[model samples]
Target: MNISWQGVFPALTTKFTAEGTLDHAAFKHNLQAQLEAGVDGIILGGSLGEASTLTVVEKEELVERAVNLLEGKVPVVLNIAEGSTREAVRIAEHAAELGASGLMLLPPMRYKADDRETAEYFKTIARSTELPIMIYNNPIDYKIEVTLDMFEELLQFENIQAVKESTRDVSNVTRLRNRFGDRIKILCGVDTLAVEELVMGADGWVAGLVCAFPRETVAIYRLVKAGRLDEARTLFRWFLPLLELDLHPKLVQYIKLAEVHTGLGTEHVRAPRLPLVGAERERVEQIITDALAVRPQLPDYLAL
Candidate 1:
């Protein structure tokens, strides 16, 4: 289950019913859309998927269901966002048992463990399962920076294969590459930074906004990797407004609203997370409307 990790892999949002149950139909629809759009892989139960609130059974079922639907089309990777080292290991083990191809692991959830402790937490989980692990380095939102030094230590473990470089400082991508070279694959985790990171040599994207605009997302990645910078930037300029939604505090709601406009997703979210309203809702709708109105046509070279 070695993932090539070289293209757009949406950090998919978990769909839920109005009453907060898993919406299987919508979930499958979204998954199918990403696969059809030529995403390199699928990552489930990430922050955008509301990982903190989903129970163990729900997470397990997510992996099981995605694995079934993917049917070997692409790799199915699970995100482990637990607080306790023990819990993270348990979840990683469960993901491996459920047939996940890889794991996107965050540091101990909520608690900002020091470097040594953070390394140990990740190391413990890495040992618990045979699945390849992508260390999620999102210091901006997660408050834990998996420093180059920390990664230097963690990479000793063979399965510690990749990094989701979301420090919000694109320089870190270059830093990781300078240090690790190709020993570790670097996946750009920030939606807005996708083009810059890819241009600067990110191996792939763990895209958030891709859940809504899958074709454009994949297009940007493909264009960049194919050395078509001019074409990539053209689409990126058009994509930036929607990409900004993935950076907002309410990104999940914002992206889902974009999805609604594109007919790819719904506005429904789980409890404690409600739909947008009033001026806020109007503002988001305006952005989506303007983008869809002039959505750039894919270059003839891109058959997607």
Candidate 2:
């Protein structure tokens, strides 16, 4: 699949069975929902997809499964968050071999590399693979900001095609555009700020809450691009509470619960991340349930 990098691309959650194994059935079910909702691409094994916990073999299996399942209708992108440049390059090359359409490359994980080191890390991976790369510039969580100077240094590599703009500042979208112009596509990475960023000239969205509410997510993007702000704002206002679930520390568990309510997935997460319980679970559930109770009637957004 050729990536236009101009629409909704879900940062999909990894599904697990009760015994703590990959649940291909649940994963495929959610993938189908994303496709049916007219998403632009499918991104697997990212932060939301729990990339840290997945073994190398398991990551490869996900890439293979998504590649076969989507079958060229859309691109299948694997997220590479390795700590070593060697391993990151290895995964990039392997993902390309397994027919992944692109990669979401994070800065060296677990180490706070300086600007030069970070740029070199990304440049090395870009040189190693033919697959296009989206630099995951999420400094707030990751601690290493891919500043514009770093982007300038890394721009020589053609495969470093985009940035998942998670700086949590809407103005940064304009800054990227001013510096790089269209040389690098920008996808909004924060779910709560997706619409705001989209309106401010983001090329697309790398969405998290989209795991459960695929249609609404896609609709918001389509409406914004179509210049239907009133409708987009109305739908987004209704979606605000649910979208906030993606901002929590336990976003994986929170979103999995949303998926359960939506019948798109189960809440079985891997070890070190348990299912939500008690008042926390009840509070999140109430947010989801209240939004669903008055779920807005979407416009015929596909027509846009």
Candidate 3:
């Protein structure tokens, strides 16, 4: 299929009921909210979506729910990176069958991978489905790194169309842009460093924080894309503190709390993951309020 995944596509969070059941209504509301807020596309079952904590059936329900609510308003991509090649393949196949736009292949979590091994993993996932795949390269959370050489090899696969580069070293983004150019779209994964990476040369952003304030983020993106670097940097600097929260180890709790505080979405999450409270919750609350209190002005069209 013709592939072009770019712009602000937030990895939409999957909300749950207090009783621990999938809150389909909340999920639909957030998906609709994102599209309404001006995101170019939506990603389901990602780290922000708590996919790791979901069962197979739950994941299926989650993806299908997004598709139903989105109603083809924009593209939808799903994370199929749960450390199993076969299982990920199944998820990819289902995503395609259900009309998803693409797959975000995450490296095997719990351990790091050698360059050659990681290259093979990407190739395997690329071969599994016809849908274009975006390599989810988040070394911090997954503990797996896709080397530049590995990236070179992976991009050769016709189906591996793009990437979500989350490495802290934003310079790597410059390197990839210089090397690949228009061959593969480079999406900046970390919200905190998005402006820096874009300055270095990234086509789009796959951000969690954007779900909370997409209008602001999308405006920043458009400014950069439109050659207004100074304006983008000003917005980025102002929003830097909030973006840093996405890098926190307890990122999920913080994000959900931001959702709760802003009336952006619900903070209810599943077990094995507790709702933030006490000092942690208080800190996250402070972060949310601190960011929203000074919400910057962005362009109006990104909301369309």
Best by lDDT: 2
In the predicted model 1, the residue pairs found to clash are none
For model 1, the superposed segments whose C-alpha errors exceed 4 Å read: 300-304
Better model by lDDT: candidate 1 vs candidate 2: 2
Q: Is candidate 2 or candidate 3 better by lDDT?
A: 2
Q: What is each predicted model's overall lDDT from 0 to 1?
A: 0.89, 0.93, 0.80
TM-score of decoy 2: 0.99
Candidate ordering by lDDT (highest first): 2, 1, 3
Of 1 and 3, the candidate ranking higher by TM-score: 1
TM-score of 1: 0.98
lDDT of candidate model 3 versus the reference: 0.80
TM-score of each candidate structure, all chains considered together = 0.98, 0.99, 0.94
Top model number, TM-score = 2
239 in model 2: Cα distance from truth in Å?
A: 0.5
**Residue-wise lDDT of candidate 3 within 1-304, one digit each (tens)?**
3447778889887888888888877777667777776777878888888887888888777767777777777888888866666777777878877778888888876557777777887788788888888898877777778877887888778888888998888898878878888788889999988888877778899988876776678878888888888888888888888888888777787788877776777878877888887987787788778777887766564533
Model 1 lDDT-worst window of ten: 295-304
